[model samples]
Target: MAMARRLVLWGVLAACVAAGAGDWSPGTATFYGGADGSGTMDGACGYGNLYSAGYGVNNAALSQTLFNDGASCGQCYLIMCDTSKSTSCKPGNTITVTATNLCPANYALTNGGWCGPGRPHFDMSQPAWENIGIYQAGVIPVVYQRVQCSRSGGVRFSLAGSKYFLLVNIQNIGGSGSVGAAWVKGTKTGWIQMSRNWGANWQALSGLVGQALSFAVTSTGGQYVHFPDVVPAWWQFGQTFTSNLQFSY
Candidate 1:
């Protein structure tokens, strides 16, 4: 009888341990490294992707886990630079980065393009995301996806007060009609026309030729023109349309 009682007790203990020792609660999933303007924005925005990111340190502890159950949040981001040099939240992005993290060391913050109010901004004026460090206690392996080429900022130029020739590479995603149009924001409302040299310098195609094409831009004196294909507006080339916006100058 004692042997059976002890066996039952052991079973009860095992069940209790199992109840309390479940897989560590998942924190906010984050994503880092790779081109920002690419489709990667979907993952960075926590839509869904191969990698994950974002979470505080030592999240497995039983106490701090009560702060948030992550019932409705699955967002994440950031990564270590070189595993030795810890200073500043060196993001893995390679384009125009506007750091919005109020606290740069603990974790990452949401991205609110252009510095506004207390939004953080990492000056892209020099080498970045180098010499990152990690700890053994709170430091755990997060997800980092290395998808897509960093081609967004490979050739972004602005003409503040002059007319310039720009060469646009046009490529149809699939169909054979309306290759789409390129627009430029001239420091005002509505997008202006982006021209192309048909045979000399630049050339732009109509909506009936290909899905992708380049256009020239001209800014009057004291006027600033920002290309529409700069950010957030990707060459929609997915379904019957896709854009291979390679370069423009």
Candidate 2:
């Protein structure tokens, strides 16, 4: 009976793994960048100059739901052309892309928002799309799955806007690199939730000019890291702070 129970458990685990793999859904893909594309800098996710830092237009913009209001920023995805739908797809070819921006809801026209309601979709950079599908096809069927992001260096926090309206951009994240939620606390105040304003950026509308700030971050994989007093009281707008804390895979 014990041996039979072990086999049953193994069977259940295999079924779970199969279900997870089947979650990768078919979707439509479109490309941007180059003359007709959205500019490489100043994306809705607040990531600027996507062409720099060796990324070089190898990025993508996801629709509202997929964007998860910036939670998907810095996340990676494995995308493959669905050859079953089009002859232009290269058999067994796939391209991995980093989510760097948000494709606004207005662009969703036919199939929910750019990455919304109906099916999963990716607005990839032209170069990234061409890596797996014929350029002339414009749009092609694809299947995508979220993957772990590989990054180096510690996490850095960049402050923007004014003291009353604070915006913090988290960068150089590691492990399950995308942030799911972030909270901030000042010297004397209780923890305040920060709302995702765009790619990698979390914002809070409060006067925190003179207080030292501590942060707590949760990653997509449910790992949490609390950075106590990561920012000094003297931290000023436009300045950046680095924390020694990081999430593990």
Candidate 3:
């Protein structure tokens, strides 16, 4: 029998690439973290340290509408300060950043609730914000576009959890960046499906210790990549492994 194609469940991501890299949409932006992005660690996407994760200081926490409940984690966006809407905009400048956190809504705050539900906003890192807007402009209007992530290396999987459970954090992804689904396979066993456990973490209930690990990942943009025996049988918790394979987008 012929094999069935994977289901296209994340059709929303199609809109992101509808017009390619030049497709810009209106939005608002504010800065967070210190100038060096030291305060941007341990974000909602579970990326403990952006610098260590190879994301550097150029990152942003997306508002609820764009965040899509962590599904947007790892996605990249190109944003330019809109000169037409704000005097503080530094024209001819744009910055690309990865989605690493959530700018949660604050219903209690009246004037400062730019991240409120349904709003398109970006709470960018200070360094990223300073790249396109004046420092004095606490918030600036911006035109943003979903862009492909250019990563320096292959995808990285950070392992955590106990013998009874396995929690994997996928990072350094290119292409669509956001993971839609994942499956883990052990050397001695067949492919085991994993479920999203918040942010970029995927979880598996069974333990496959002492067996080499492989992964099959599908991005929100419908791209798929597979890594075979990426982790040795001696893998341990808290250790990270890098795959030679990556999606080119």
Candidate 4:
């Protein structure tokens, strides 16, 4: 009897730990980008190739409600097939994915648009979807929660745009990966705030050529990080810079 009592106590403790994890919210999920997730490349987040951006195949295109007009770019989500709602769920399985695109609503399709406006849906990469559900299910009821992103190395900045317009796509961010705001500074100028161009890209109309660049970024979670002189004076328009600093998860 004592041993049984101890087991019950352990079970209750484990349940408490699970409850303390991020609050699960209801949603639906579907697979896309083929079985290898190759079709998911060059998504709306401006991340280019998922592999090149360090997001790998574990990525998803979120519905408008969750996409937040690209403000949710680079954010991470923990998803699980809700076994209580579907028999196709791979029980006890969950996957973590990064938001890399938008699952636009298709008003033309009859009952086919799961990612319509106001709906919290995830059009996940095939590999990611398979991790938590059977392929035959196609679409499944799911529960997901926003979670801190886990990334290797530090953040990366890909530079683009023309002589007067500077566009930077920030990638491989950790913690709350969605960037709320960003600012750039040159060796000779004061901090110039950048505007969200689209997706994870931030733009500034200032000409900052031939100057070593630094950046201050703030996440949607309100955490701030600064990378000083991350780009050298010789930086080119197509160059990408890496910083050794990252936000804590």
77-96: candidate 4 lDDT, tens digit per residue:
98888766777777667899
Number of colliding residue pairs in model 3: 0
Tens-digit lDDT string for candidate 2 (2-113): 4543454345434545766324566778888764334645577665654332234667888776877677887788777766567666555668788887776667466554
TM-score against truth, every candidate? 0.21, 0.75, 0.89, 0.91
Per-residue CA lDDT of model 1 for 194-226, tens digit only, reads 553321112322231222222323321112222
Per-model clash counts, in order, read 28, 2, 0, 0
lDDT of 4: 0.87
- Model 3, position 147, has a per-residue lDDT of 84
Q: How far is 103's C-alpha from truth in model 3 (Å)?
A: 1.0
Best TM-score goes to which candidate? 4
Q: Which stretches of candidate 2 lie over 4 Å from their true place?
A: 1-22, 35-38, 51-56, 105-117, 187-191
Q: Which candidate, 1 or 4, would have the higher TM-score against the true structure?
A: 4
Q: What is the lDDT of residue 152 in candidate 4?
A: 89
lDDT scores of the candidates, listed in order: 0.24, 0.74, 0.85, 0.87
lDDT of 3 at 21: 42
lDDT of 2 at 154: 61
- Of the candidates shown, which would achieve the greatest lDDT relative to the real structure? 4
Which ten residues in a row are the worst by lDDT in model 4? 4-13
Can you give the lDDT of residue 142 in candidate 4? 89
